[model samples]
Target chain A: MVVNSSAELTDDEVDRIFRALADATRRDIVRRTLAGEASVSELAGAYSMSFAAVQKHVAVLEGAGLVTKRPRGRERVVRGNPDAIRRAQRLLDAYEQIWVARIGRLDALLDDTPPQQ
Target chain B: MVVNSSAELTDDEVDRIFRALADATRRDIVRRTLAGEASVSELAGAYSMSFAAVQKHVAVLEGAGLVTKRPRGRERVVRGNPDAIRRAQRLLDAYEQIWVARIGRLDALLDDTPPQQ
Candidate 1:
């Protein structure tokens, strides 16, 4: 699925991505799937949870665009989507820029420098 | 306050940070405060919402370690915390690595390469 658009993401999209990532198990699933596509059963075998639970986690990752699943011979092979991750990184980077600018202002104030006119 | 802990953050802490960032208004508040420290009243004046609402947003940001508030005269001046943002970036970077590794494995498989022995 096309996860990226030129416009910024909505709040809900960001919420979904972060929420999907909040769980350590889901994060591990993403990590494993990124290495290569794997069947739901294959992934379930590695986890301590039931197959249903792993499937649900995969669904959450899929919804967040973090993982994409394709049917293959009565099984669904899941793959991680790197572009979605890059987009998330971009969002964090923007916030970092804002944060750095704020720190710079504080430094100037502490140094008793006049505002640039 | 020291936001960084050598230990990894707990699930609840991650929840608080993401929840605080889920609102556009709160995100904008972070952006503005990052530019420079500002009194609650000064920030509230810029938004159409009630002062209480803005105050609550500041509280959430502060809880997330995204912003820090210090008393100044009879007011509190809020400043953005860049280190928190950096830590968050680190988390996302780790995810990106996992996603990339998964993709590499898939690519190798697609080329009909045998499993690395």
Candidate 2:
């Protein structure tokens, strides 16, 4: 099911999503936003970094489509995009399928033949 | 299920895993290795880059615990590690759970009241 939903993501998009998620601060930001949307200022206040650094991290997440920014009273509110998360989930699912099939083959090889019922 | 298995990986390991997966060529190598084990030379031939380049990609993958290399006579054979894949899947699974719960709350908020059966 995850793999079926995977076609919409470009390899570049996958690269960006994974790269953006590779950092601790960014992942925490994603977690925070996914639970409830927050502004850059709110996120920065929670971390030990400067507002600009946190803004950069938010920008990376936005570029990867993992989070979205919308104007709200002169502040940009960031919310994690579930669809983008699902896309990355699906890419990993495809890889999971590959190994599942490979393991199935290995099982068959070890069995020598189908077991009698 | 993936979330349950996610406890085995530390945040640092999760970072390494995603960082390694952020590259297109590295991701391709993971797919190929999951499908079937191959020597470094064989993998190098399949790509446009030099053997050392492919080797570096494999090193990154290995560092992230995504793949394993074993000596086979004259060369090292590479195979994708299912456990590592599962660990990364679990991390995403945690994020998925967060959003799923958030959506449930949103649905509750949008509902005027419980629908009559």
Candidate 3:
């Protein structure tokens, strides 16, 4: 019944993931967290924006499953989720395949025809 | 000078590609065109929206390099471009690699430590 079993996240899921990634601030958060888990304050310090803005970005990333927050003492540390990124990559790969198949069909059609005047 | 040579579209390029893909109508346009080249009217017939709206979506796809419009008599036939899709896929692949490397570092850190009580 399911068309794609691998990384077949629903459109809603893709929307959430992509929307979260749409912002440069959130992207920077993902990139920084990828280096290692960091507390909210630590991430806030790197940006010129308000701490609340950075917090909101982190929340968006968490909602998209791109980042996971764990409690450490009084702080919460956020870590990047590789599986989620892999799922997003798989979706893009599917789109790539669709285009490839289209090209293949055109090639077949061209091959079937004789030299044109 | 370039950080990523593999499908390394600039931020502006990514913004355009993702913005073009952000719409459901444009996504449908890409999907339909992937099946085969279609005239604007033919593509318009499948959707409830106006032909002009469909044409706009087609234009967006063309701008994103996802579709190529070729003149055929009075009608322009739109064909999908596999190379652009591949380029986009490579960008997503690079993001996936970033997350994977992040996880690898975490695993390495954990391996260095003994079981905690």
- TM-score of each prediction: 0.75, 0.87, 0.77
What docking class should model 2 receive? medium
**What TM-score does prediction 1 earn?**
0.75
The candidates' DockQ values read 0.50, 0.78, 0.44
Q: What would the per-residue lDDT of candidate 1 be over residues A23-117, giving only the tens digit for each residue?
A: 77887787787766789999999999999999999999899888999999899999887777777778879988876766687787789976679
Writing each residue's lDDT as its tens digit, candidate 3 over B1-117 gives 123335457666665566666566777777777777799999999999999989998887787777888999999998876666666667666666776787788899899889998
Q: What lDDT score is found at residue A77 in candidate 3?
A: 94
Of 2 and 3, the candidate ranking higher by TM-score: 2
Q: What lDDT would candidate 2 get against the real structure? A: 0.89
Q: Considering summed lDDT, which 10 consecutive residues are worst modelled in model 1 chain B?
A: B1-10
Ten-residue region with minimum lDDT total, candidate 1 chain A:
A1-10
**CA RMSD (A), model 3:** 4.8
lDDT measured at residue B42 in model 1 versus the true structure, 0 to 100? 94
Q: What are the chain A TM-scores for all the models, listed individually?
A: 0.87, 0.85, 0.88
- Deviating ranges (above 4 Å) for candidate 2: A1-6, A108-117, B1-6, B108-117
Chain B TM, per prediction: 0.86, 0.83, 0.85
What digit string (tens of lDDT, one per residue) describes model 3 on residues A15-115? Answer: 66766665667777887787678999999999999999899999988988888899999999998776776776676677667767877988999999999
